[model samples]
Target: MTFRQKNKITVLGHDIKAGENCELSFGVANLHTSSSVDVPVIIERSKKPGPVVLFTAGIHGDEVNGVEIIRQIIAKGINKPKAGTIICIPIINVFGFINLNREFPDGRDLNRVFPGTKNGSLASRVAYKLVNEVIPDVDFIMDFHTGGAGRFNAPQIRIAKNNPKLDKLADVFGSPFVLYSKNIKKSFRNTCHKLDIPILLFEGGKSFHIDDQVTNTAVNGAKRVLNHLGMLSTRFKISKPKKMPVYILDSRWQRASFSGMFKPSIAINSKVTKGDVIGNITDPYGKFNHFVKASNSGYIINVNESPIVYQGDALFHITTKLK
Candidate 1:
């Protein structure tokens, strides 16, 4: 929660002093066509020295909703802080983004390769550059993400359990839900945690889709966090969340009982009771219809939006315990 007062900071080998704004290129590799791909890193610093907060999204190329959140943050000038430095990397997996795919061109999941080696795979090289060149000077990070594979996640802030500092920060972010999640091995969140850099992983909406409600929720949360840190500009107004976030201690996915056309009757963030019919599965031939009942009484944090689902596929993510 504390940051050393820095007069000058270097990012991507470029030195930027206080009260300066810079846009640096994080070009990792070229496309198969040999075209250049440069990831833009937008930065803004204040005259006063304070914390350096990094806002990142598009770790998975298909998670366009996350990219949109960062896009709005920059387009609305929200990245211009009143104190400290605000760094925005709206898209990270440019290769996947370019191909409209989730993984890098070489089929490696970028999130799985962290603290990478210099002479590794394409995804690993990007991860290496990010962990080595960028993360060293970061005080905190807010990594945006969206649900994958036709699943829609409710807007939520995810963090490891039992960190008071992260808990307070998550409260300040004020999303609809705060789900306690463990960091994945070799993931960006895990690397940051190992480096002692606190981070909040935000998951919302669905891949390749953008919802206004989800975007607004994340943007507002970011603004609130900036305000809490005394980095928000006076020109921006912060709105309080309608209700306090639900702290989810444990959750489970309710899988589909039958494979067929699927439709969710309950929406994300909706609370349900045990045995409630939250969704249904039906065959295309109208021979059978199966009502998907809730496994237990809890909030629906994620819903599978895919029309056709298979048996044992995750249909709904329901909370099991609350803090």
Candidate 2:
């Protein structure tokens, strides 16, 4: 195994040997004044050669749930994968993270630009660096994400369809909800697929505050994958969820019929039937009031936490079971 024997590796101008782990500051951007901001990526390699896996978070910056998930894994230091290399970038979009926003300083969505161009915008440059240099070398990827714009995801795994390998990987993570997404033109997932590297996306909670349920679920999911891959020992028997994951075939957002002070009747992940009152929209000063009902039956996957909404705004992201 390549990792089993001593080997030298250099990244960001830092040298790392097999069976070791270290943090390297990767240069991303520089301001006109003088200094540049470099992001930190932690690399861990095993003595035995195996698969190379990567975990990334903070693509949206305010989506700190994913960022925290990676941090906990690194802080615990329990996962010294016995076979392969694990590289983690707990915070990838330093600009978005520091600003508590979803996009780059230039207001471009980082996730929308992939296989980035160094000569392009800041988001483009960062994406280009990872796609050209970091992503091609990995065998597997587990990208973490969370809801944005006050939207909350019901702890789920979003994957690509028609790929058994991706399906199996998603199953291993074993979230309550498994969403199959068609490729978006410039998204990271699309770019990775083009490179033939399988990537699994785990999304839960909302941006900013860390939700305990979603955070813990994501951490365990990654460990489960390592155990399955023979990197982490499966001995001692890890507990499984009482129920299996629900596969979602289709989903839609329940938009507001009119603008008002929103009052939700249900919580995230709640089961509802067609015509169920998802919420009520009422005006504080006037007698105008309206109820939002489900168009079809299934689970309430994502909902906006913000009560103030306008007409035609998406108020609820509802999911339907696969036939």
Candidate 3:
């Protein structure tokens, strides 16, 4: 976990020296109306030398909870480090963010396109610029994210298993749960891994929604990591996690048995026994009501909040095994 000290770092073609604070534009394209889009890249550096950390969010655009966590970090002056450089990109997909959609105008998931071609689609080109320009000097990254659609994910950190470096960092992040997941092909996490940059992928709450508790947990985790790296400013106080995180090794989705209105009786992060009633699916006329039972005794990490569901829609994400 030791980082080589950097006195001068170049980001997006800007040569930033020690103790310099700069805000640069990450603009790639303009809107249909020809208006320019500004993606601000905020960089804060300390006179003392330490590791360079990057905080990024809004890869999906609709994941406002992640955006909020970074926003609070910037607003509270958390990005001003004590002995290193901190970079913050609060929103990455400005196109999707402007349209209030999850994908780009070209219908591409920004997260799926990594190390893209210079002349490829809009998403691909942006990915290429990020990989080639901003990421070359970053030592570590913390990309914030949230569950898709109506699924609410409990506060958690996701990392590829068996990497002791990632395992120790995930523990330092101190989220309530740590899930081991494989890196998807061409994903941002995979790209960072290929470049040998350590990253911690955080998931919590739901897209387009922000919970105070979730925000607090993520913010505190960021503080703890910065403190660990000797980069956090002395003005901030680090709070120990109330409890140790649950490490999930395997998990399964509990799908709906019948198509109808759905309500979850069990909350997220709740541990349940096998055959316990966790939710119920019923028709609008009340003619039939089927109670959903837990398939195994484990924790409920994600709960789908959609009112209407199909017969096979994922209703709950329950842990099948733990470490």
Candidate 4:
């Protein structure tokens, strides 16, 4: 967890100097079949002195879109940076990514266990390493993520509510939706905010899958941010939204009133008024039917997309925001 010295940065026995780029192998805890889980860090340090920004993904392991976005950045685009360093961690939660799960082996969310202790659980240790070693050394950061399985998120940016500066960064990233989010306790974004390091959380697509449009949004967004920070040159084309972004105040899940075959009447971004029917839950044999209604007037941000549902299951996620 220690670095050799500044200028000649040593991370997990890999030495990186100015203008040097390489894949640094960070050894995580040893497994039965392998000596250690080698977390590859793609480090690129420019000759000119400037800021250091980190692009991180796969914190939940199942979120592959962010991982692919980071991979695309590191593969070729990052070399275009004019000054400063860019560190890309395509997959942070190695165990979760390997198992295609969200939580660590100890049944804890890695993102929710920031600034962890060395003697703590696996998730804690990983969080500790990131908080202590990675984030502190970076000037800015971009954390990419996606919706859970069966749910899709419109390309959006989530920032701490009331933070105007961060909101501007979200604008630079150019997502059509900007969520003024309440910081989750001990989350990666929360930790960064506490440290006063500028960070952006980009959410889009769905877990374990990739969309070409969403991927481009993410890549161009990163390019925009880097360009803003004076690390990368311009000529990067960012996608523009025809409709203005919706500023969300809050969101809540709409639970199914009946256990039955569910069919959604609303799609993502569909506008609805209060008491509007969003979907229908009916018996398999078409005996009983219950129409799901919206509680607050807003756009349908998420649809369960599951054909079958049980009573009390969240079938729709709606927010009280309209643009």
Local distance difference test values of all predictions, in order: 0.94, 0.82, 0.95, 0.79
Q: Which clashing pairs does model 1 show?
A: none
Kindly report which residue stretches of model 4 are placed more than 4 angstroms away from their true locations once superposed.
1-15, 241-244, 321-323
1 against 4, candidate with superior TM-score: 1
Winner on TM-score between 2 and 3 is 3
Q: How many backbone clashes does candidate 4 have?
A: 0
RMSD of each: 0.7, 2.6, 0.6, 3.6
The candidate 2 region of ten consecutive residues with least summed lDDT is 1-10
lDDT of 4 by residue, 5-99 (tens): 24655544556677888887655687667657888887888777667788999999899889889888877575356777788889999888888
Q: For candidate 2, what is the TM-score?
A: 0.92
| Tens digits of lDDT, candidate 1, 1-323 | 79988888888988889999999999988888899998999999999988999999988999999999999999999999999999999999988988779999889999999988899999999999998888778899999999999999999999999899999999999999999999999999999999999999999999989999999999999999999999999999999999999999999999987789999999899999999999899999989999999999999999999999998999999999999
TM-score of each: 0.99, 0.92, 0.99, 0.89
lDDT of 3 by residue, 1-323 (tens): 78887899999999999899999999899998999999999999999999999999999989999999999999999999998999999999989887768999999998899978899999999999999989899999999999998899999999998899999999899999999999999999999999999999999999889999999999999999999999999989999999989999999999987999999999899999999999999999979999999999999999999999999999999999999
TM-score (C-alpha) between model 4 and the true structure: 0.89
Residue-level lDDT of model 2, residues 126-203, one tens digit each, is 998888767555778889999888888889998878998888887888888889888788998889899888889899
**The CA-based lDDT of model 3 is what?**
0.95
Misplaced by over 4 Å in model 3 are none
